[model samples]
Target: MTTVFRKALGALPRLGVQVLDLGPGAAVVSRRGGYTATKMSGDSWMVGGKRPRTRTTADGWGLHKAAAGDLCARHVADLLANYEVNCVFDVGANKGQYGRQLRELGYRGRIVSFEPVPDALARLRKSAERDPEWRVYPFALGRSESFEDMHLGWKTMNSLLQPSAYGQRRYKRFTDTRKEQVRIRRLDEVMDEALEGIAEPRPYLKMDTQGFDMEVFAGAGRRTADFVGMQSEVAVLQLYEGSPRMNEAIAAYEDAGFAITGMYPVTREKTTGRVVEFDCVMARAAAAPSRQG
Candidate 1:
């Protein structure tokens, strides 16, 4: 019945519906109008018609509640504030979602967003047009400059790495990849220009390039020190083939002189109830202390 319902939803155009599993005996249907209905263990449905109101933090991941926006956005904002971040490089900015969230969270820094997906980049540019502080770039960031085929996943889950078998089995959308050739540039080559005109440029790097975050990080080279803080979406379970696991990614960041400020679960697997990914925020160890200290 679930499979049939999902197929029916897919058949409909512009339905804007997504079915997400929240562990055993729990499922959530999210609709276009910001409505959500959750199926509980005993076949009871908990429905909310309006958009979800999210606070900064909860006891855990808040899985029982309606899908909250990025659980770590506020944390990122806080880190930005703490480090006096004056500019931000929003790598993999999909339609300016993260930039908007940062603004709502009271961050007034300059946002330089990079996106390679044509459709998404168009929307991202439009979103940033009214806000002079927000800038949009039209190429993907990677370890080197070149063109690569990006596999588009569900929503903004597109990546250079192929989705793994586990990802396809857990999320049906992984099977529907539409590849697009995109230009990739190294951050080291563009960093100075991106930061141009920003006074006392204390930068923050926010990356959500699905599984290619490390590559983006590598692109920064020794200039990683230029950032006061950074955020990366690391996989707890390898969703994309060749993507680094959580531990490896964390270690890499630590080795690069960044220390974890906070770690927030992004999503969990249905069957095993394991965290699938995390929005891990880190800051340069030498600069992580709070102003109040």
Candidate 2:
């Protein structure tokens, strides 16, 4: 990328243009107006435009969502309102970032966060001290109850599965191999306890367990339908051993009767400029209220 081109790209975000992909001689950009601009090569740009519509907002949530240019947040806000999400079960709630983001989006519902790592749990607890609606749990949710070793990577990259060679090579932080034996519990087993004090719980489940999302879903078992909506980190490229690919994860959600609402790229491979993983949001199709004539 040339300096002039880089500078221009930097300024595009202010205009609501998000650079989704950039390669050796090509680029893919999208806008809130539902248009995609792709550069084939040598200044040949193909523009795919949708019917323009005004984006008007009166609330703090809409303002934050529009200003941040986060499609995931906007989608989550939509689902919460549509599905009447009164409680959120934040699986893999590392250091309460997701919870904090929820509050920023003006969500005032109950937030129950689960984190197994001692260091992360400590920080997550401290951050929720001022918020009475936010609660924390100190165990990981998985397919079954057992003491399993968790790969403790740098910051929020912790995982239950071992990191692959490609993962370590592509992301240097994954090279860390510190292991901690953490308690793994099934969400179904503790679902009642988690919802004990909450009244009329309409839940949304969000999982970011570093490739362990499938296991967490499995742990939820038959109670998965209790959640009106869910969000998971689906991987296009396998980063951890035994982690299901994007297709498999999406299939699981679909089989469970959820319809995909949105997918926003979370990370990209630097060399290939391909999406490594994305936040996939899905809602139970049957949960939507029928429209009256």
Model 2 lDDT, full chain set: 0.82
Q: Evaluated with TM-score, which candidate comes out highest?
A: 1
Model 2 Cα lDDT, one tens digit per residue, 1-293: 36766777778889979774444544566675455554433433445555236633322233333323365776697789878788999999999988998998779999999999999999999989999999899999999999999988667889999887778888788866699999999999988987887778889999999999999999999999798889999999888999999999999999988889888777765445577888899998788756511
Q: TM-score for every candidate vs. truth?
A: 0.77, 0.75
lDDT of candidate 1 over 18-124, digit per residue (tens):
65544445555565545555553233445655544663343234643223334366567777888888999999999998898888878987999999998898999
TM-score, prediction 2: 0.75
Candidate 2 residue spans exceeding 4 A from truth: 1-69, 291-293
lDDT of each: 0.81, 0.82
> What TM-score does structure 1 among the candidates reach?
0.77
